[model samples]
Target chain A: MDNKLSEICKQLDQLALDILKLCEEQVKCRVKLEEAMKPGFVHIAKSRYIMGNRTVCSLQLPTEDSAEFDALTTVVPQESITDSEHRGFKLVETPKGQDTSGKSVLRRRKEKPESDASTEAKEENVKTYVDPIKWFGVLVPQNLKMAQNCFQSVLPLVVECANVQGELQRVQMKYQKLLKEKELLS
Target chain B: MAIHSAIKGKLISVIGDEDTCVGFLLGGVGEINKNRQPNFLVVDKHTSVGEIEECFKRFVKRDDIDIILINQNIAEMVRHCIESHTQPIPAVLEIPSKDHPYDASKDSILRRAKGMFNPEDMK
Candidate 1:
């Protein structure tokens, strides 16, 4: 049919586009890989970049030339040390001399060891508020209702697919029967 | 048993010589889609390697097809694509045809499995 032909043409067009994209991607990746495998790249593969083990490809190793190198020191310059100190917060002066005591000791009133009433209140709150089992029971019914609704929505589509599969099985049976008949006739 | 049940919902696609194709089709592996493209491709001497490669690519992309069986020789024509395919689902299998016997050394999947077992291959 014309519809079938057109559909095939459309599929062919899509397939062609997919193949084009895949080939382009393959070429891009391959070119990138080839570029990386070249002599100058990080991994200097001996097989591709060399002829003989005795003969070195690059006369000099990648190490920095001593001619370009100079001796270095661990000594911190006085100016840099001063710069480091300056980078920190401006030192705050104590509010107009209440007490300039070097040791401004902080001491608190010893905490109330525990009021039995507060302890009992905490125990009561724990017992009343945080019964996990009770919370689970409350949420279960609502979750079950949601799950049932979800299953109800999905069931029709599942049934339709099953029906189509059953139809396909019937067609397959018929095809098998025809083949059997042909075998007998032959 | 699991594979049997799984395959019942999914179709097997084939690409092979005419005789090989006919044998599988008779075994009830052949299917035509709504768009009128067959799940099986029959490759004759006249069939180009490019066409075989295209059909192989199409079969790999089809979600409905779960397994692909190609003639070992025919598979060689599209070896690059087959080796590149890493997905376990829609597994690609190379089978021998009348003209060409199966070569264990050349089969990519078999070679991969062998490599897995060989300790030196790990290096």
Candidate 2:
């Protein structure tokens, strides 16, 4: 009897997890669309433009306090703030050496191109970087990072979905038990 | 009931082709438990039926896995074992692979479920 009850519970548990997975997928799609609608969220064409033989990669300014249509010129090589004033638009400097969890989903450039090397070195610790290959070039870094944050932030939504699934399963199990009990009684 | 506690640690196991296994692994469902055992099995062209059967048996016996997702096509290869498995926990689900989409007609569970009711029950 206990075995049968537990088996039912186990099925319920599996269904609950499936509910959570589906809810997460739906939330991701909707959140990505809404996030994309925000100002400075969309990357302009100027960033990846090629000039002459050299492909000049222009990084966007940190959009926190930027006006509409605020953009950037090419980043200074040594990353001196002095060059900011000389350049037409402000260049939000990429942080040199800090690894911020859940933010700045920046890939290590050609300097650390061996993909596994940096990850392996950090393997000893609880590494928080999402597997790079998962979303490497799919969404731009800013959009991807924002989507990740939104996903984590809305975990409660997934939890709620799981709770509802659990309740529904419990009701189902009880209904089955009642039917079985009635059969035995008769 | 106490045995259920031992099985409550949630993890997803997989028995699938390269594309299916790689897709789930990339989704961050892959894990190597403390015993250095992976929760996934990648079935390649060189993989034998015996090896696939052994891995399926091992995954079914595992306490941590709450779900075992098998590519529907590969599940067809081990239909006997799948048909015999009655446990509701470690629920085995059939998923579509890149090369092969799911066919409801070939699903063992669905076939078994259909057998449970009388012709009158359908009405």
Best-fitting candidate, scored by lDDT = 2
Give the number of the best model, judged by DockQ. Answer: 2
Per-prediction TM-score: 0.37, 0.44
lDDT of 2 at B82: 84
Summarize candidate 2's per-residue lDDT along A1-186 as a digit string, tens digits: 766655555654554455345434433433442343222112211212312112211111111232111001011112237563111111121222222333323433235546696686664333232342233344444433443333333223322322333333334344446445534543
What are the per-residue Cα lDDT tens digits for candidate 2 across B1-123? 343222223565678875445434433445554355767788878889999899999999987665677877899899998888765555576655556655656765545433433444222
Could you tell me how far off, in angstroms, the CA of residue A26 lies in candidate 1 after the best superposition?
30
Over 4 Å off, model 1: A1-186, B1-8, B117-123
The superposed Cα distance between candidate 2 and the true structure at residue A47, in angstroms, equals: 22
User: Per-candidate DockQ versus the true complex?
Assistant: 0.02, 0.05
List the pairs of residues colliding in candidate 2: none
Candidate 2 docking quality: incorrect, acceptable, medium or high: incorrect
- Residue B5 of model 1 has an lDDT of 21
> Residue-wise lDDT of candidate 1 within A99-169, one digit each (tens)?
21111122113454666987756533321111111211333333323322332232222223222222323
